[model samples]
Target chain A: MRDIYAPRIHGIDTSEIRKVFDLAAKIQNPLNLSIGQPDFPVPAAVKEAMIQALTDNKTGYTPTAGLVQLREAISTYLKPKIGFETEPDNVIVSTGVASILFLLFQTLVAKDDAVLLLDPYFLIYPALVKYHEAQQYTIPESFDEADVNSLNDRLKKDGKKLKLIIFASPSNPTGKILSETQLRLLSNLADEHDAVIASDEIYEAFDYEKRHVSMAKLSPHRTLTLNGFSKSHAMTGLRVGYLAAPPAYAGIVQKMVTLQQYTMVCSPHAMQWGAITALKTGIDAELSVMRKRRDLVYGILSKVTKLPYPDGAFYVYPDVPIDSADFVTRAIERRLLLVPGYIFSANRNSIRISYATREDILEEGAGIFCDMVRELG
Target chain B: MRDIYAPRIHGIDTSEIRKVFDLAAKIQNPLNLSIGQPDFPVPAAVKEAMIQALTDNKTGYTPTAGLVQLREAISTYLKPKIGFETEPDNVIVSTGVASILFLLFQTLVAKDDAVLLLDPYFLIYPALVKYHEAQQYTIPESFDEADVNSLNDRLKKDGKKLKLIIFASPSNPTGKILSETQLRLLSNLADEHDAVIASDEIYEAFDYEKRHVSMAKLSPHRTLTLNGFSKSHAMTGLRVGYLAAPPAYAGIVQKMVTLQQYTMVCSPHAMQWGAITALKTGIDAELSVMRKRRDLVYGILSKVTKLPYPDGAFYVYPDVPIDSADFVTRAIERRLLLVPGYIFSANRNSIRISYATREDILEEGAGIFCDMVRELG
Candidate 1:
């Protein structure tokens, strides 16, 4: 029975997030902050558009790359924004940035190819690279200006095998936005090394201090941009995302679309219709609300533990005095849900707290977190 | 830049269906029968259910395996019907049977492992196998009892390497359903060889003459049954499907779910709500409509080319005297669209006609097909 699976199955578990979900599920009124999705309801207008689509019977399969007009809509939005020499043919619609990233990695990485991830990377990047039988190498350090120079030195030594670099801005655990200079450094390295940059800009709408600069905007020829409506509009269940590549890599884009066509066909047709509205209606109010939450978390958690002030997304990664798994377990015992930093980074001295919930929950969760840290001291 | 892609991508192209889609896009009032989706709208109740789900704020991602009650709904429907010793834990909801198949193959098939497909298989099967770097060995002939014996004898010599077999009943191009005896023979061969079975039952409700028998029922210990709401419920655009495996292979199921969690997360949440209604509502009316169209097609085109009287699904594969590509081209010149047989099989002298459209359109398409054949004669 064990032999019934590919060897990869034995190595792959259900994801460490499952551990947190299982723990959170068992607790009564747990002050949970583990998951990275916005807890807000989808925008009313977007929901209305989807309902209208269903009413109009837009349930037939769209072209595999997605509806041409939706692709056009995406390119129109991104061209002036992301600085791509872009068009509809350069974008492929997908169920999420998840599926787009999966296809992108599989399309680019061969066996033994080295894919570079920024340290404290998204939890799933290594999993994807491992499944493709590729090697995963994180950058020498985080992408501060000094760290970027260190990364360039490492690349100078072993750059030829570098196939892809996937780093999210306003990232998952740290919520740190890459500065424009940082983006330029990575873009230059990717261009010099012939590596592709997968700028996972899923959190583009939540930037607090500066406008988000797409890695593709910094280096269009060597970057593939991944973004979606999931976070910006609280449409995670809708499963709408797109990968925008440059025309110079149309053949690779075609291959990714072909893989998606034979796998998922297209994203759910009705959702694609809803996404048209989602992109049009901005999320300024929601962003402001989240900005306050981030501020509140930074304000309170800073009293308890050392942490960098997060500039984007909705999470704060703070250093914990105890082992992260032990810290999470103790938090669970107190009816609090938190993710260990190791889930995002190789470092294990910190924990990630998402501030995507209501102000009251965020306040309570941060209060409990502070009390726990004081107790640890 | 094309050289930047993995070599596996070089061998892949857009699906053969795309050629039909592209050609049909240009034709005005074309009698198109090249692709295999129903022209019917999604059932009203199901559409309303999805709309209501969106209204109810079911736009957040479900658990990776899908909504628990949805998986329970699928298992409850199949338990008495397919005879699987299964539970909700045994299922993973996917965007469609296409994604399910892709994951199943990647989960089960190792590189160079021999996979057995019935000849004239669905076009996507080989593409999926090749993507996994697997070797595809076809059953000696087709899935008649005679062919089963031929396959058994063939496997007797190479049984150790026979990893999996994928066959669709009430199949896409030919619309042929496997007899019980044929299924039993396949079950015996798979058991003797330790090979897994992927039963693609996407067209289960389309069977008109005999009750559909699932391969999982005959080989529950060694089968993965794939089914979905896309076909019978006419929700192709909604993109909902599931794979049900035996408890003995829980690890495989878990692996599949993990792969999905990291890739697509889950199917669209609103569609899952629609799928619950889709499963409960019967497809008797749609079946009868398609049955009548099948009858209309056989009456007209049986005179023009050699074809089995298709008993299920919406398509009939008819042998043509001239080369299929050439025949399809000539038909296209007259604004008629058909898929050449070479797209499905090594055989190149036939074409596939789908009767999934309105009866009037089916009649016109069949009439045009017959007239073209008569002209050839």
Candidate 2:
């Protein structure tokens, strides 16, 4: 019975972040700073569009790629923003950015194939590479020159086996945006190794300091741009996202669609209509409110400990004076929820705090978190 | 450049059923019978429930398994119907039944593992097996005692290599329900070989001739029962489905939930509420209507060719006088759409007609189909 599972799933456990979510659910109105999605409701126009599509009986399967009109809307909305021509043929609507990553990995990464990761990474990255029985090489910390050199040496060693270089911009667990120099270096490394760059830009809308840059804008031929509306439009439950492959790699897009035809069939159809409307609705007010929350959290936490400056997304990772697991446990006892940094990295001295909640709640949680760190230090 | 793809995805093509769908979209108001879902709009109660859930701001992610109340509702409803207890712990909600199949195959089928298939099977089965690089053996037409003997010999030869024995009862193309004796025999075979049974019963609600018997009721320890609301409530686009394993096999359910956490995150959040309503609302009227269409199709097609008796689902696979590819093309030229049998089986002399559409269109299409066969014969 123990042998019932394949080798791919043998040691893969439920994500530790989801465990924190479960723990938060058990507590009675704790100041929760562990959620990964925005704390806002979906826009009215988007909800209405979904309802109307249901009323109009758009309740059957869409084309395996997605609704034609929705694909067109995504393409039209993406071209100018990403600074590249996003043809509708290369845009595939999926259940979420997560599914796109799964499909992309399933299509490209073979057993023992190498996927380079920039640490600290999103937890799902290594999980996917592991599930495909692929080899993962990690460059500890930032994508600076030192890390870039390490990546170059690793790719040179692995040669043709390095199939992908995957990273998130405005990354989860850390919210650090990759600089243009880093992106360019990665593109060059990918070109030399014939590795595709999978750039996850789901947090593109949350860049507070500077405009977000897409890897496709820099390396159009070899990059797969992954973005979705979950964080931006507050539609996590609606589960709609898209991936744009350059026309030069339309073959990959076609293969993914065929895989999607057997797996997801298509993303939720009525919700896709809602996503089309979401593209037209602006979240500037919400963005401004979140920016203030980020500022407030940063103002409080940086006073107490060494913290990475987060210019985008909704999270801030701060070094804890004590073990992060011990600190997280103590915070839970005090009715505060946070994810330890070890879940996202090999390092175990930090915790991730999300500022995506109500400003008052996030402010109160930040004060409690700082007090805990001070008491322990 | 072609070497960029993994060997697993090298030879897979988009489903031919999707090709027919694309062809139907290009034609004008053709009497379309190739579509796989119910033509009726989703039930009003389900639609209204989804609307209410959205309004109530249940728009964030649910637990990876599903919403608690929805899982409980599914458990409560399935117990009496399946003649066994369905615990929430052993159920996992997924994007669709197709997704569940994908997760199940990915979790259990190692490289070169054997999966026994009953033909004419759903097109997605082999595609999933192929993508996993597994071995698939087919039992050509039905599950008669002769086929059972062959299965026994195959299982004996394969020994521990057979990881799964999968089939769709109230099947997709043929709509043939397995007899209880057949289910008992397969369960014994699975028990003897330590293979799990994957019983796809998505069409259970559409059974017209007799009450559908679940394989889980007889072999609770070995069977995984998959059912969904897509056909029952006409909510195909809502993308919610569940797979219930025995409490003895809760480990499999847990592994699938972990897989879902990374791949789908969860099924569309608000739609799970709609699915809760779908369980309580009866669709007897829709079932009866589909039964009449089944009768009408069997009547028309039996006169012209050898047709498999379809007692469930929305399709009938009838042998054609000409090659099925040629027959499907000829039908399309006359503004009718049908799926050639080779898509589902090695046999290439049949076409699948879906009676899920309007009665008038089905009637018209049946007449055109008979005339074409007569002229060709």
Question: Number of the top candidate by DockQ?
Answer: 2
Q: Residue A291 lDDT in model 1? A: 88
For model 2, residues B99-151, the per-residue Cα lDDT tens digits are 99998987898878888888899988888788778888888646677886776
Which 10 consecutive residues of model 1 chain B have the lowest summed lDDT? B140-149
- Pairs of residues clashing in candidate 1: none
**Runs in model 1 lying further than 4 Å from the true structure:** A152-159, B140-146, B156-160
Model 2: which residue pairs collide? none
Q: Which parts of model 2 are misplaced by more than 4 Å?
A: A157-161, B157-161
Q: How close is candidate 1 to the true structure, as a TM-score?
A: 0.97
lDDT of 1 by residue, B1-377 (tens): 43677777776667877887787789898988876788778888898899889999999989888899899999988987677547899999999999998888778888778888876788898888887788877762245667766656765666545789888987878888877887888888788778888889998889999757988888888888899988888888788999998877677788889899878889999899999988888877777888888888888888768886687888998988788988988888888889988878877888999888777877888888888888886
**Model 2 Cα lDDT, one tens digit per residue, A113-149:** 9898888899999998887889988886566778777
Estimated TM-score per prediction? 0.97, 0.97
What are the RMSDs of all candidates, in order?
1.8, 1.8
Error (Å) of candidate 1 at residue B52 is 0.8
